[model samples]
Target: MRRSLAIGTALALAGALAFPSGAAPLFSGPTDDIGEDVELAPSSDYADLEDGELVVDLSAANPEAEGVNDDAVTGIADVFRVRYNGSQYAHVWLTHESEAVTFYAGGEPIESEATNVTLAPNESIAVGLRVDTTGETADGLLDEITVHARAADPEDVAAQGDALSFSGSTVQTRAPTETSRRFTVLGASAGETTTFDASRLALAGAAGDLTLDEVAVTSAGGSVSLAVDASGTEGARSRVAERGAEALGAVRVTVETGAVERATLRFSVPRGFFEARGVAPADLAVYREDGGELSRLDVERTGERDGRVRFAAETPGFSTFVVAADRARVRVADARLGQTTVAPGESASVTANVTNAGTAAGEQTVSVTVDGSVVAQRVVDVAAGDTANVSVPVERDDPGEYAVAVGGVDAGTLVVEAENETDAATAQSPENGSDEPVREPAGFGLRELLGLVALLALVAASLLLARRRPW
Candidate 1:
């Protein structure tokens, strides 16, 4: 019994030394525990261990210092770490339930590939996060970053079973620092323009001097206070994104006492907004939501200066306004002729397919040319990422072969036949198998017999006169 006990003790001691300290038992069967030993811990200066979970606070974070105009901040490298204490190999990945924050791993955004890692016993990986405050007016808990561990490799087979273990961290944000301004317009009249010092209303990342001008209040003469805020709403941001546009920001203009009839407001937009969205200045537009309907306002680019572009927009009343890039590109895809042959003075048509491969609807002019001359033209409206058919009627007065083209594309030849006068007369004739009855030829009538008798009497009188003269 002593010899057997000594041998078992020696074997147990060897097995204990094989794995590192604080590692789980070796998994031997399919029913063994897989990922329950995984834990998450703060790995960087920005993160903290709270309530057994990692937390990152962005309340005092200033994005303006990073030269970013939009309200966004990126976390440091390895903000947090995911450690697996299991004995068997496991597949680990990170997921988040937030739209405002995005996590990163290994200096690259953890959208898909970077989020995944394979770990043996006592292995760990670090993660980071980026928080955007563009549409975040007030802030609280922003996101929950979750780390999932599974026994089976997701690449090899579908992750059908439940996760073995899951751990997460919370991200919190506070309201960003903002500067606001209020202007008081007393005894405002129609057709009167008022300017205010709107420089303070610009966002924290805005550079250079800012100005507001040509503010025309079309309401009745009264005193009103105009308040402007430099923040935007989440609804406006989502709507702009759905339209394939990037929202620069939103400005909220409110009337303290009563609403106005209409107003024309001009403001400065950051030049960086255009560069970041990769949109041209001409595509910039303003949108306003009224009565649950979002409508685009009449906007015009006035000028550019001091690293900012100026735009004037007409608004219905006091409300929030969203500035975005609305670009529309229209082109012709194909052209076809309705009929290749037509007679003179007959009408034919050319159809042109127009496509708008842009973010907004646009109008395109489809022109049909015959023999180097524009025979028909039409203006067609095509929706974004859609195609529309535009048909233009064409007529030919001369009989000949003409080269047909639509929207600058060669469509083919159009042949107009000469008018056949004989065929037209034959169509009207009864003898040519027409429906009308045939008429008989005209015979001797009373009028003709009377005319012949008068002629004979006159001839006899003339003969008697001549005979008397000769005798």
Candidate 2:
């Protein structure tokens, strides 16, 4: 019995060393001065996380000096370190703007893999850290993570002897942590009811056997009908009905383990659902459910709208979200017709300017009416608060006076006239209908009489010449 007790004690001590019991949180407060060498804040705000999963959180902000922008500090350098009871069970993954921030495991900057970020003096961006367990062994207690800040490079700081400040947080994981636990919503149809299988809920970590307590689906800023099937052999399933109005919303699923460890499942507002509700495809703001108001949630849009808007969200826990925007309204203006007069057998064109005087973009048809009858029409697409001219061609085959209108509004008139055949002929022949008569020369001048006598002499001479020729 003594030998067995000794072996058990040894194993327990070894396991404890591998997975420490007490560790700091996963985040630290902000470090204001990079030149000040300091220790990490040894407290954390996170209590639970799964293995092989990353939970990123914002660090606490350092108190700002009066009238000073803390983000203006130049050449800010960051160094990350993980402190534990001499076990490599956990590794710290650091990032800036979704890019890796570490070179090697020791918080060394990778020259090639480094992300060079420059923030404006007035602009600020938060650095992120992801506590990832190797999942090699369930050993945890990988406690404190310290992020050091400096005004210069590590080498320069070493050479120039500038100081650095650090902040830290504790990290805790559920015992026997699984690689991952995530839930997927499948077969969601936009503008229609969708049912998801509960049995297929992907559960990981120490609590793989997850039980659905309840499901509540509500619009972020709208309304929805949600139902959950808790009494099922496979697992808890969910069904969400279509929203009656166009708005952003989310479906939150509350789940529990046999030990009663609670976790919530959250998803972004599906774009297809919003589109089915007549929501225009514009930039949508994502918000996580807070107490009464929703807070912004960072998400990546998948740029696809099938039955649902597909997107990926990284968060510490499950929560509700709202994808929201102002609804757009479209309106048509009174149509105006231009250049309504034309001759017969010619085409007369009418132009009406279409305007969307509302906040929404839409298309409107502007028709041309001749003598209270629809003759020609055109479709005009106008953006919100914008206008476009729609042109319709009216053919005047016969002569008549036609009243022109657009969209039932009297705009102008179209007078088609046949060409005046009599005037046209008179213009072509000016002397055809003249009243003056033909007249001879006013006087027979001497030259005219001499010419006549010469003509008679020539006739007599020609006769004589002919007689002589015959002899």
Candidate 3:
């Protein structure tokens, strides 16, 4: 019992050392076919594997011991190991059987070497089977085959009778080659993005897996692998890794450190809108998803403007878009203060609010005019991060329309008013505070002339008579 336990412990330790840790699971597929070959090898995926070794024991069922290989055996065994790559495995047996009659592999011919072996009721034997995954083959993961088997009689062979099977798995490896692949660019301008698909890569033409290294984008900002937050999927990864670089004006794609495989990729650049505002316009270059430039578009100056430009596309292969926001104008939108509204000869204050809704800001003038003449002006020093309010006072001499303007934009009329025209004094009417009687000026003068003539005649006649006598 001690010897048996020590042997089992040693086998377990050896098995543990042979396999390395931290690899994806082995035989990670459905176990469907566990036929005669299962008896040749016991495996975790025994129920799923199709090709392996198989052994049969038909002792009681076939009392004649007549079978396909002409082997009269109390037990049978098959073996499986070594899968792909250059890794090799110690001979591990694979088998299925009943202890009545038996079957064997293609090693011994009929009657030449007898396969009959004796065993006690519940006794078992360990067989060794090795396969060559030495180099690439048809299935592409295995080599040639070399297996070993032996049997010994212990007790009566008629004790055990039931179908038994076993199976296991191994690992192999392969080298990298050139191929094509599918890639995607997440950010791009609408007009500058392509809509290419996976079929365009055509990796099969390269006969192996494709790898892309040292990929760079014109707008990638000198960074590599522009997959935001390490979320690079099999479909694609950006060549430029600099933050927001994938949305820049240029990106370069190539195999910086690996092989190329043929594959198809489909992707698109993000939608973009460009606006022209303020004094200076912009000149921008646009690139397609395939890294091809379309054309340079010119944006013109629009006073106090607000608008956007949109782009869209659909292509067959992978694509990305990039936008260049070069030299665009910034502007503000707000009310323009005009002339103050006040009664004739009255003083009132004029005020205007300037709100910036653009990328740039500076001081602007608000000039107010009343009755076609400049009445007041205010110079508010505007800053990039601040809003300004301008206020000024003006004396209104007449009642008419007042005009207000800011940054060359005209704001309509402001009205000033005087008292009503219904109350007035006329020559024929006498009213309130005046007690004088109503009369025409010419008639009043005629009545006063007769009195003046009488007084003047009396004085003159006396003076004339005295002067004549003296002379």
Whole-model Cα lDDT per candidate?
0.57, 0.35, 0.29
Q: Indicate whether candidate 1 or candidate 2 has the larger lDDT.
A: 1
**Clash count, one per candidate:** 0, 17, 82
Q: Candidate 1: worst 10 consecutive residues by lDDT? A: 1-10
TM-score of each: 0.33, 0.30, 0.26
Candidate 1: where are CA atoms >4 Å away?
Answer: 1-326, 385-389, 410-412, 421-425, 431-471
Tens digit of per-residue lDDT, candidate 1, span 318-410: 666776678677888888788989999998888778888767778977778988898777888988889988887787889999888888898
Model 2, which residues run further than 4 Å from truth? 1-272, 280-334, 369-379, 407-409, 425-471
Query: What's the best-to-worst order under TM-score?
Result: 1, 2, 3
Shift of residue 443 alpha carbon in model 3, Å: 26
* 71-186 per-residue lDDT for model 2 (tens digits): 33212222121222111111122222212122233233322213222211111122222222233221323232223222333453344332222222122112111221222121
Best by lDDT: 1
lDDT tens readout by residue for model 3, 1-471: 000000111111001101211011222333222110111212111111112112122213332222222222122333212111101111112222212211233342111124322222122223322222222221121111111222322222223223211222221111111122222222222233222322212121111222122122222211111111111222222322111111223322332211222212222221222222221223322223344323232322222212222222222222433333322122334444444456777755555666543223445555666545666666666544457776666565778766654443454455678765443334324654555665655674755898899999999999999989955
Colliding pairs, model 1: none
